[model samples]
Target: MTDSTHTIHPVWLRATHWLNALAVVTMTMSGWRIYNASPLFDFKFTKAITLGGWLGGAIQWHFAAMWLLAANGLVYLLCNVGTGRIVRKFFPLSPRAIVADLRAAFRGRLSHADLRQYNAVQRATYLFVIADAVLLVLSGLVLWKSVQFPLLRELLGGYEAARLVHFFAMATMVAFVAVHLAMAALVPRTLLAMIRGR
Candidate 1:
């Protein structure tokens, strides 16, 4: 297809992408502060890096970000489905293709020549992160309202188990974000494409 016939990142996608990014960052920082209030482990995130000055404030920030994430995520998912971008971009995944892509990536031979199409690794990773975000939201609901969501709480193996699941999900998301940013840095055009929709 000619350049005039396609856009790398559509406007709705770019909007949702930036909004989701903002929500995730806010939730993560506030979450660190909330986690510090009731230590799940001995370690604590530094006050400097965490959001909100106190536990109550942090909880407020976390809740606000939660709503933003939920609403924006819904829009993103619906748009992807409605537009059929989800299937076209992330479907037909295979273990063999992913393994080959991984090997090529490690060897610095994976191609990013096509700005519009995802390789097997990108498809897998994006799909994984989407599921991870859903898990985070479900587990977070249990923690946020255990009394109201007792069934969900029990399904996740009680309150404490939900917390653990949420923590791990957050960690996984953070790692994904880190690698995503690294890849963007390595291929700056990808970042620009998201912004410019070229």
Candidate 2:
């Protein structure tokens, strides 16, 4: 067996991963505040878990975080593509593989013996998250400037529809974060590998 202490996450991966985590947390909190300002649903996130004291303040925070997320995400993607990590680590995914891995995971039979390789479930989740983030950014742009982003606005079914899309995208990201944290806890060494790059 290879030494688990060997580099698993490269420096760039570690940096971008943590930066993305920060941006996601910041955006989610501020977004909750924004949602409370004009909720589409009956429920609202309490102030204790949300950032920004008011609507305007929340908008500012959310926009700021959005830029951070966008920039960091771009860098991460470029590095992944440049290094061929995107194809090596996340490709060859199939529906059957995902289903098999997911069942194994639920049955506590899945392996984390290889930190450098992603199981099919991980590949699908990460890919979905990447797509979801892109959707969030586009929908957010539509909501922030409907007239300025007429093409995106129309594609998303207009301003009001864009708002729903953004909200749901945010919700999906939050759920992913929750599961990610839980999985990290369940496999503490994986967290260490991320932090220590091994």
Candidate 3:
């Protein structure tokens, strides 16, 4: 198919993508609020940008967003894998190619003409984010239901360890969001394609 006539992102892809984005953003903000109630580290996120009014409210929002994120992510994963899009679009990431792309990106020579196809670096980043999301969900499950999921909790090294893993995964996700926004700023057309599925 020609580029002009081709549809880059299908409706399901676009819908789930945005829904997942919304879920993650809300979950992250509310999670910050909840974290501030009893921090694990030295620092705490300010209340100004946090979601929900208080700790209980934040927990409610977090759980709501968690369900949304989990459901949307499951659909996205199943659809992508069933249609072979996962293999065709994201697999076979070569370390050499990723390194080359990273160099080009650093040198400000990367191209973003083909929104349908991802570069090596982009593919690697997406895969990493997906893995991180899975880790977050699993660790969260352990944190939420340690008593019911004793095996899972044990596998993740108990409640406290699971919480630590969850925190780091959240931090990684936030970093990914920052980089994703930067990339969107650099290539505005990519954002338009996502919005309109061009």
Candidate 4:
């Protein structure tokens, strides 16, 4: 396809992407603050960088951002699926191709010329993150409403297990965000494309 034929990210995708980013960041920060209250791990986040003021405030922020994240994610999923962009741009990933791409990436030979097409690693990462997001939402629900969602809570192995799963999912998403930001730093145009849809 010619340069003019290349399609940028649709407005819906771009808008939802940024909105989800904001929601996730807010939720993650506030989540850390809340986790500190319960002493889940040895390390704790300082209040300076965290969203919300205290445990109660953090819970409020987390709940508010949860709604935004869920709604934005649903819209993103629907748009991508309805437009066939999910399959067209990210499907048919092969293990062999992913291995080859990893090899190329490690050797500093991976190409990024086709902004419209996701490379094997990109496709795999995106898929993994989507699954991770779904897991986060389910686990979050179980943690939030363990008694109300008995089946979901039990499926996740009860309240304690659900909290663990939720923490792990949040960590995975944080790692993904780090790598995503690094990739964007290396290829600034990708970030710009998401912002300006060029």
Candidate 5:
């Protein structure tokens, strides 16, 4: 967690992270197309196709991407269990270091130890993104079949509630990706590390 060093992200971590990114992007787009269908708004869940030729087809794509995301996410989580990367390098809760990082950022500089690594802000963003993805999966399930999963539906305050939460969370993630990309562009070397194993 200092400067003057570079520890490459393991290949498995890089692979799962990028694959998951693609899956999330595809799923969000296709899922939005599906939502344009019935929309479940106006106090109704009537069958309707809002953005595509068929709601069913959109559902298929959405489910496919969802599964892909799940697989990548699973691998990422499993790798974390034994890798110690989560605790040692990625958890993002080191208060003192975080404070220092903030100070450096305000001064338009990277903390000495974070020059070649994800800074505290980056670590915090990554953690939030991870948590948001988990929420997306859970909320999707809650909205998938409210009748079949009564307990989950109830926990999410019913299908409508779940749907709303899921949509908002998905939108939030989309926004995060937009911001993430801008940051990547600003710090090209950091992006290079992910793509070219720098």
Candidate 6:
């Protein structure tokens, strides 16, 4: 392909990507604050203290960010599919090459194509993150309004089970974001590519 044919991610994607990041991070923070209300992971077995300020306020932020995040995700998915970006990027590939990609990535030999350095680990991590996001949202709905989503609650094994999945998903996503940030900082040029759409 010529220089003109180079695949620069569309502006819509770049905008939505950053917006989604903001929304998710906001929601995660507020969600953690509220989780202190019950403390799934950090919940003390002793006394309940409104550690972050107020439960109601944290919930307010959670719901507000949820709407924005959902909107951002919908547009990202729709446009990527409608424009063939998904097909181009997510299509099935050979196991052999995937293994080679990982070996190369760890060996510091993998020069990313089009500035997207998703070797095996990245590809798998991204795929799981998307799946986990869907699960987190669905499980959240079940917990948010169990009466309205009884079937979903049942599918999740129960209200408590759904909550457990939601909690773990949030924790996992935070870890992923931390690792992602570390990688981004380690490769400043890679970050520039994302912004410049190279």
Q: Quote each prediction's TM-score.
A: 0.97, 0.96, 0.96, 0.96, 0.81, 0.86
lDDT of 5: 0.76
lDDT of 5 at 106: 75
The residue pairs found clashing in candidate 4 are none
**CA RMSD, predictions in order:** 1.7, 2.3, 1.8, 2.0, 5.1, 3.7
Cα error, residue 13 of model 3, in Å, equals 0.7
Model 6 lDDT tens row, 77-116: 8997898877676655567778887898779887755564
Task: Show where candidate 4 strays beyond 4 Å.
Answer: 1-4
Expressed as tens digits, the lDDT of each residue in 40-140 for candidate 2 is: 99999999999988989988999999999999999999999999999999999999999999999999999999899899999999999999999998998
lDDT of 1 at 40: 95
Clashing pairs in 5: 2-113, 3-112, 3-113, 36-50, 37-50
- Poorest 10 consecutive residues by lDDT, candidate 1: 1-10
Compared with the true structure, what per-residue lDDT tens digits does model 5 show for residues 1-198? 323145466678779979988898778767777776656555422334222346777788888888899888988988987777787767647778778877887787864334345677777877888888998898898877767888888888887888888987887898999998887787777677787555
lDDT comparing candidate 6 with the true structure: 0.76
* lDDT tens per residue, model 3, 148-197: 99999999999999999999999999999999999999899988888887
Q: What is the lDDT of residue 19 in candidate 4?
A: 98
lDDT of each residue in 1-198, candidate 4, tens digit only: 325465478789889999999999999999999998987888888889888889999999999999999999999999999999999988899999999999999998999887878899999999999999999999999988899999999999999999999999999999999999999999998998898777
For lDDT, the strongest prediction is: 1
lDDT of each: 0.95, 0.93, 0.93, 0.92, 0.76, 0.76
**lDDT tens digits, residues 1-198, model 1?**
437447898889999999999999999999999999988998999999999999999999999999999999999999999999999999889999999999999999999999898999999999999999999999999998999998999999999999999999999999999999999999999999899888
**Candidate 1, lDDT over the whole model:** 0.95
Question: How far out, in Å, is residue 198 in model 6?
Answer: 2.5
Q: What TM-score does structure 4 among the candidates reach?
A: 0.96
Off by over 4 Å in 3: 1-5
